[model samples]
Target: MSGTLALASAIAEMDRDALESLVRRRRPQAPAGVLDPIGLAAELLRPDSILRALSPLDRDALAVLLGLAEEPRAGLARDTDTRTAERVSALLALGLLGVEDARPVALPEVTNALRHALMTAGHRPDDLSTPPPSRSGDNASAPPAAPPSADSWVTAALTAVGQTAECLRVLRDRPARLNRSGSVAVASVRGMAESIGIEADHAAQALAAADRAGLVASGGSSLVVSERAEEWTESDHIARWLDLAATTLATIPAPLRAGLVREEPLAAIAAGLPERFPLLSEAESTAARRFVVAAEYLGLSSHGRLSSVAELLHSGERAAAERLVRDLLPPAAPGVYVQPDLSVIVPGPLAPADEIDLAALTVPEHIGVASTRRVTEASIAEAFSRGITPHQARAAFARVSLTGIPQPLDYLIGSLAERVGNIQVSEHHGDDGRTRIVVGSSELADTLTVDRALQHLQLHRVDPTTLCSRLRADHVLAALADARYHASSPRARASAKAATESTAPPRAQDAHDDLPEALSDLVERVFLAARSEPGTSNFTRRLELAIRDRVPVRVTAEARGQQHTFLLLPVSLSGGRLRATDQAAGVERTLPVNLITAVESA
Candidate 1:
């Protein structure tokens, strides 16, 4: 009862618009009659509502709030800095702190519920220290970092962009299955790492980030590259990297995000989380650690400091962030040098389309500021198996080559084109439904039959120039292509394309899509209900509430043509009369409810 009275008193001090705004921000639906001061106060004091209000608070604000709650009688110290003043003002606006006798004070019920919840969730009071100043505002500027070269980070960032593209390609080709927990299976993760030429941990982080960026999504039973992934891949390097950084800042858990946007040290975010959020679950702790490594690996941060681009993005200044990061990126190479040694050297980052085209024909040797790739017989054969014609391959290289194609490379392409399609894959006519592979010569047939990579097909040698397998024709052709045998079939290319496209998953519907409208409706209902009712009806309703709880109220009434005031315990209300015992004179009294002019809790 005292908690209700105290909270009601606080709510009464707020203007109607201010009260309605606070009610709307809390995540609960306002029931009918919530416009009453006591009714709204009770709802805001609920434990769930308190927790919802606490979520967006930074560390310093939370520290100040908890300090007020823990030592309510001691009162807060005078605000000496802009940061402290801002925090106190925020708390006051949230209604967590109310002005009482010109000093900030907390509601006992709200504070008690919050402290109990924290304690029950394993938060120890002694373990909580005065939280460090949040890096969210002017304090977000970090100390200057020691460096290698000025452009080293640009090289690092460019390489990460390329790696991300490679990772997306891997997922598109072979969608990974989900485990029981709905995360990518560990074996699939290992395979992805091996395919992308990175360690398993780094690959996992890349996958996590890609999922957050909407480049990857869940298929029915597995994870697949999203439909938007191709467009993202083909976008400019600056847009691609900025998308990753912005998505990461937007979707990561609040604790780690606070560290990032606040410019706190990444390494300390996880360790320092208990001081922010009470305690960290195992899953939260792992995610925080992984995020720390991934942020740096993605070039969004360096050492322990956040990059200026990330800071700008977190502040909702997308254009400024893009400009800052663009200034730091190295220029893209217009063309590559095609040397006679069958090696291509890229002096800088290539445009996305050119990079994709070159990757399709040449094997990457190194990928960095200056990349090196080689054109080999097997590489050309694989490209041919994927349905790239010799003429098309020549045109691709010529288009991106700064120098004319060297004669050695030209001769090699022609010879390799002639060798391709020397083997053909077709369906067998037998009812058993098998595939047949035929070679141009007995020597070629003998080599294909004994090849270790082709052994998985269980190819049975029927003659010097022929072999058969129980697998489908497309499967056999793909295996042969992967083995660099340059086998061709009409259905192979379509099947590969279908396999890639079929893995694109449907977009999941957001569960909270209608939350904003629901909150808006609740606010409107409360405001309308308050406005439509008369003051007499409100006074009568307050008397009914006080009578139901047997609480003392200050009641003013007109009785026998004279105004009288009484401190009374409201006992009952019926027959349009309020029955009560006057507390000051210790006497029973009854007043016509319609004649009661005012009723407020004493």
Candidate 2:
């Protein structure tokens, strides 16, 4: 057998990922059907096998080559233009074109791909009178561009990042841990969103971005903040926003992203959308808008839409993000506003340290454009408890307040600090003669009755403020302080290693891996979820077929509390419980058979 025939045989046996990878390589190789041009050409005329590798321009070039298939030249420039010439040369290099009668001719592979594409779109042999499906290019979104004069978008994205991270913390750090899955219970998502005071849809996007960014990841039983979370929290707000935005843009359809990075506008790109994607025109338009949302928030597009800078980020131009921020957020002299209502306002984004310091001493009322903080004596004392001295805390407020710290705030800070540590906890012997927890307050114990922890012990009256729990004096004091009794514990024991042992902090990751792999996994996941007509009779038969064949199927089931569009390959359907493998998570899940409301093709 000819070597070309052997190579073609090997190519035909490869899996989808392997085959696509090989074809996608920048080094275009001789296609499989080189030896028997007639046979190979016939196969190429079939659609799915090769058109997946061709862009619209490549397809158009292939169509031109087809029109001249009967001509005999080694190669054809088509036109003198560089792009046209390059396209023709690419066809030759990819083995899509070969010499026939000494004229450049379409290989069987190209013809087959074109035919397959046409027939897949319902074309008929007798209907060559109309346009071929391969030549129809109305579906793609146009190349995207940003409008001018828009507000900075990075700021909005940063706000989203903050909100997302905090929401993840609420979910993962809760006493009752939430379940973690590729398709987590939407009810849980809604509950967490409610806890964080955001819409479920918004929270879902944030969670997706956070998961993609590697700050939060599945930990088998529950979602947990990964080690990356530490570095994420430490990174500058702008850096965090850029990271999330990169992950978001990475999710755009690859062809669209490719075109954008190559400097195509959305209108131009839009022309190729309808024919390529399953999405409708509105969805295509929304996707184009999606690419611009994060960009506009980053102030990369002052004009209000996607800009060249955003395309740069999508293309892995890391340095472009910094440049965009620097060019857009020019440094301005800091300014402050102090109001009669005892609030401090920063006219713009705060210096990093000042933002943290302010949070420790004030409650934010507003965030964008101008930041407003309402100050109270309790907040001032809270900062002091964190080792910020009264003088230092007052100075921080003064530095950020135009009036140099309001007189009422200053006096309140002093008064609170003076008696802050008065209520104390100590280890003492009760009448029973065992070491127990007791509050040592110079003030009357009647004020301690309001402590929630004390209420848990049913201690309405505080005679020596003793609690019945087995907790340490230090723990008791901290809990009381948290409840605003301002407790301290002088007699609490210290750890033996407290003086000698110094702990190390988390090391930062230089860069994260698994991004491309994870992105691919996500694509496969979406591909596996099927939309179905709601019901059980037909769904049961489909479920059985999938189970018997070991193929993945999506089950849209509504259980008592476990409602979801589930993607799973059934492992068993016994005991009125459907046991299946969740491909996205690579985990086993069991659902009550009765919950299998709908099953659909995947």
Candidate 3:
């Protein structure tokens, strides 16, 4: 029967409840006999060929065994036929069955043995109905001793390796004891033989040969592996198999080989390696490349050059194109430049200075003027040409005036002129007592340093009230104020504003209202020191000192059968009864709020 169909048939015959009961009842001291007939039958139904091979039985027999319930001898005889009854009796005689509550019970060890037997049976060929022709001589008394074939040994060894490989993978991380079972090792060997369509005895002999070659270790029930074998298993065993197939394909003539080569890049590489290398065949080189690519993609080795090569290979190049692209891109930097007219300038490696100058000179100038307007305008234009905004220029002007020029007007003009890359000086006569100044900008002198000019005039005893009243009367200040007021009102409402502005520390009396700065600082220091101390005892002592000196003194008093502590601040202590306030509720109560075991200004 086909393996799939046989598996389906076995599954159809399984009784899940009976199988579970069987598994639960059979408690083998060892790992091998964990499953009884029912459990074995269930395993047979699994899609795994190894498991299916482990249980060999007709679907009907499997169904019958899986349906059997745990019962006493009487119940067993009652439920089963004479043949099954005899088998059960024989099993009991063999000490494989136990009596519990006067019931016939299958021991876990026996069940496990039976499971292994069934599994081996399933793996054995169904065509074994016909025996091999007798090799015995014509002598009637001749013994039936026969020698094993070489093919049998080879098949068996391969099976043993395959099965042991699987078990090793499963048990690699588990404790060694879990894999110490001789039966498990034996089962693995049998499974390997089954996988390769061979007999266990031959596979066992082949395993012996491999053991002699130092590829595998056969010690008692366990298998040991040599370093070479360990390395092979850890590395590219799967890729090796693919390479083997590719090598076989490469033996064919070129025209036929081309078809196989087209299946995958590895195959193509394998086919081309011979022409590509003097010592290696095309298939060998392809196999090597395939292995490397697979390893790199799997993240097996960080140093593998496949990623770099793959990029090049994909792009029809011989080197990494992506890395080249990354190298070709320009590096990024912070801090952009701004033109003098308040326009931002994006930094590029190369910028045309002449083009910027032309743009600056062509832009239309603004109207309106002040006493320092000309100097300010020229500074603004110069700053723009130099790729800096008016605001930055103004800040530079302020810094220079603060440090260099004592005469405010001249200082402001000089600073503005410096920002614009201009050094020209202008003398201006204004209404304020023959003021002679070096103006930087003919148009921007007022805009750049108007505030500085007003401050300078005021310092020089200029009558600001009469000048400001005259300007107010002329409607200049009113027009400016109205424009600012209109601009302040926006279409969108702003996010909620803060309730209070940040301020300096309050005095000692205001400490009760809010924690004083000195106390807050002490509290922070004390908390940190307490946390850093070795133990809780040290922490309490430090905390006590900080509280006593910085916080109000509180006396502990028992009231209403509860201990109450109150902080006796001077303001609150005047009254006999303590009135505690709740900050969250914004209410004051007669209850002692300051009566705290832990006392420190918050």
Poorest stretch of ten by lDDT in candidate 3: 491-500
Order the candidate numbers by TM-score, best to worst. Answer: 1, 2, 3
Off-target runs (Cα >4 Å) in candidate 1 are 2-26, 29-44, 48-85, 92-105, 117-152, 252-265, 268-289, 337-344, 374-382, 402-412, 419-516, 530-532, 535-602
Q: Give the TM-score of candidate 1.
A: 0.71
Query: On residues 100-137, what C-alpha lDDT tens digit does candidate 1 reach at each position?
Result: 54566676765666567557766655445555445333
Ranking by lDDT: 1, 2, 3
The residue-by-residue lDDT of candidate 2 on 232-263, one tens digit each, is: 65665666667777766666654455445334
- Provide TM-scores for the models: 0.71, 0.52, 0.14
> In model 3, where do residues sit more than 4 Å from their true spots?
1-75, 78-86, 89-602
Most TM-score-accurate candidate: 1
User: What clash count does candidate 1 reach?
Assistant: 1
Which runs of model 2 end up more than 4 angstroms from their true locations?
1-118, 121-213, 219-226, 229-252, 261-272, 276-289, 296-304, 311-324, 332-344, 361-364, 373-399, 407-602
Please tell me which model should have the higher TM-score, number 1 or number 3. 1
Residue pairs in clash, model 1:
135-262
Q: What is the C-alpha RMSD of each candidate to the true structure, in Å?
A: 7.0, 18.5, 37.0
Q: In model 2, state the lDDT of residue 194.
A: 71
